[model samples]
Target: MRWFWIFAVGHLLLWTAVPFFTQANGPLDNVEMLNWGHEWQWGYPKHPPLPAWAAEAATYLPGGPVWSTYLLSQVCIVGCFWAAWRLGRETLSPSLALAAVAVLEGSIYYNCTTPEFNNNIMAKACWAMFILFAYYGIARGRMVDWGAAGIFLAAAILSKYDAALLLAATLLFSSLHPRARVCWRTPGPYVLTGVSLLLTAPHLWWLVNNNFATLRYIAARSSTSPSWLSHFEHPAEFLGAQLGAVAVTLILATILLGWRWRFKTVDSSAQFTRTYLAWMVLGPLGLALAYSLITGAHLRSMWGASMFTFLGVLLFAWLEARPDPALIRRTIYASAIVGGIFAAGLGLRNMIGDSLVTAPLRVDYPGQQLASQVEEIWSQHSNKPLENLGGDWWLAANINVYHPDRPSISAEQDHDLPAWTALDAWRTEGGIIVWETATAGDNYETQIKALYPNVEILRPLEFAWTKNQQRPPLRVGMAVVPPLAPIRTAELPTPAQH
Candidate 1:
């Protein structure tokens, strides 16, 4: 347990610090979440509100916004680790449980990609908590366990809709598994259902009032190929991607238990535990694949982020592998080795990616500098503090994140502004509309004219990349919609300039 705490702390600090120092800007998803968090809505156009809410809350921490986001992501990873460890301890010996949780360090989803705080990161923690409490609720028929399970279930859904797969898995297991069938007769199931609905009601109401904007987003994102071969190809690609994601886990497990098959007979209690773990591990994955096959919908590899929380427990339970002190020591050493390698690789990528890649990576964008210049231009035209930004998600979000006022966002593509942004207020106060000159297309002027016929297209501004100034400068095109109110000559200092 002491060693586990040490590893957890080391992991949290290393991941948080590496991204903080190496990257110049937050990842796209992280910046987008921060922008949405500022709005503090019940739901967003793309995802549930929990991750945005979490990102917004993290900004209040001691570290500045970008550092706080990095820290928040690592905190979620560590929390998932703790939940997995507790779940493992319920069925396996303490040392074996420790080994099981430690091996998760090999999964890339838990390490390399985790720094980009998003719905997947939040769902990972929620999924682990949901499984842990759901297990206890089903096996023990306790009201407290059922209540906790309900809360986490609601949280998981609030984090990502994919968590519905986990709920379905739980129901499937409860109906068929002999040990879990007794839960139906108890008050546990009802309590779980009631609490989950009670907690989720607000988001559900938001969905209803907004006409399920998230579902529309999901539908738009789903790539359905016209070819019949897509049914097989998409699922196969998804399966292969998942296998690659967990390849390191298999390697680490083999290092701990060796290459030999070590199956051992267990008591009925242990057998039941193994079966339960297997369902939790495979059920969600199978359902996802089945959905892909039926609909020919292109599945994203990151969508599998929460499906493997019980993987370690299932692996050990199936093998009946008991780790001696020597093997446990080896597992700890291997975990450290893997963590160090990943940390070094990520650091190097962030530090030198610009020199190697032709185009600037997302992190290399000069967001702060661009935001400062945008604010300067807005000040020249309007006296009002920058209250709203209108553009595509990436450019608009980047500027919004660094902008001192933390203005509301109005996506260019949406016909109606989000509920958080008052249309009348936005029209009266006015805002800047921005886009990358290269990507905005030739019709950008036409598009802006259609929306704001009187919009003044400012001279395009160019800024050097953060890492490689010798590369082509980032050219941003801007337009200002004149406010209905009178203008004054008050200029607010840009935070970047300070």
Candidate 2:
């Protein structure tokens, strides 16, 4: 209870006076999601549909007009802390648990989490909940415990497709454990898990119906994504991200202490805890390592592993004894690692002081910024607007995922963009075009000028996001159509990810 107050204050402090602005996915993207939820479908082209509902739901909260999805991300931050605390309680003292919570939250990676409408965050929450309840399930063996775990496991799937992997890891570890046969021998938990998986059918059906376009999209993107020469300098990238997601260092210390201290003498339950840590923490990392080497798996969402690491570490701490005193040093070190993150985050925020903003990720749509701008444009053009093909899509029937009802997004992140090609024709017919651009060199802009000698650039928006920099603001530039030469139909450049 006391920690709750502290957590409340901490949560409040992190988001205190924070202005609502475009976050990772941007307002345009979120608005489209809200629209999607209103449509109430099972899935979307890119991923599951839960995030759309979550983002749209966030928009109605206090200060939502400014942008609520980012605000809600703070909620995940707090929830992560609490979950870490509970996890730490399994291994460390209350004070250490609190410290762990703080560390987990402060880690630089966690602090800078940009809210995007995706499974990364949702999966983090589910991972934390899954661990907390799995602890309960193993300890109490209550049917409800497994039921709770089942719910989380299922929700995990909806959050990110990889969640199914987590479930597999859990089952694999459980089955391999000494009591594995007994655990499965019972029909109750199995039934609970079955029902949980059954719930994922809608999403599964959506995937199958679309001929697994989402998977193809992911594969296509991964294969082409730019790879670094060597991230060996920062294996910590994944490590820091995972620790941050859990939001507690003491918890992590605790887990570490237990594993190190009691390696020789462990009980069944202790081993079970260790297994959870192994699967949740290492499972993803192992996959990512393989992906990094073999398949170019974009492990950018590696922070999802933090959901389990924090608990695993805390579980380790709780299992250690203080008399040895060695655990104390480990606890201190862990706390320091976590605390340093918040300090660094604060320092960086102040250092930048909003001097300039940029999104490091090279993207085609300034979707979030575009949302607000498009909304304004939509309002002005209540009379006449051009149909937007959104972007290139593929064989799958793509629905418009843009937020504005006015500029419908063509469900094609992969196929031909009729909208881009038709921009000039639409303008000729008194149609207003709203194009999104990241760099100054946009093919669409070239096309507009080429097709219409008098191609009027209604709005030229320039925005850039660096890897870890403040996203540059959307600068709207309007160009008027000056009579020019006939534009050649040229192939638009492909995204590195695509």
Error of 1 at 317 (Å): 1.7
Candidate 2 achieves a global lDDT of: 0.52
Could you tell me how far off, in angstroms, the CA of residue 464 lies in candidate 2 after the best superposition? 14
**Tens digits of lDDT, candidate 1, 1-498:** 886798899999999889989999889889988988998888988889999999999888875677888999999888888887887887788877778887888889888898899999999999998888998888777899999999999999899899889999999999999889888999998998999899889999999998898888877777789999999989999999999998888888886567885877788888887888888989999999999999999999999998886788888888856457788778768877898788889999999988998767888888888888878888888877998777655777888888878777665444333644555554588888777777766776776666665678888888899998889897877888888633333211111110
Name the runs in model 1 displaced over 4 angstroms. Answer: 379-383, 415-420, 441-456, 485-498
In Å, residue 46's CA in model 2 sits off its true spot by: 2.7
Whole-model lDDT values for every prediction: 0.83, 0.52
Q: Name the lDDT value of residue 473 in candidate 2.
A: 54
lDDT of 2 by residue, 60-139 (tens): 66643225655555565566666767766665556656655554543443455433334566667777788677767765
Candidate 1 residue pairs that clash: none
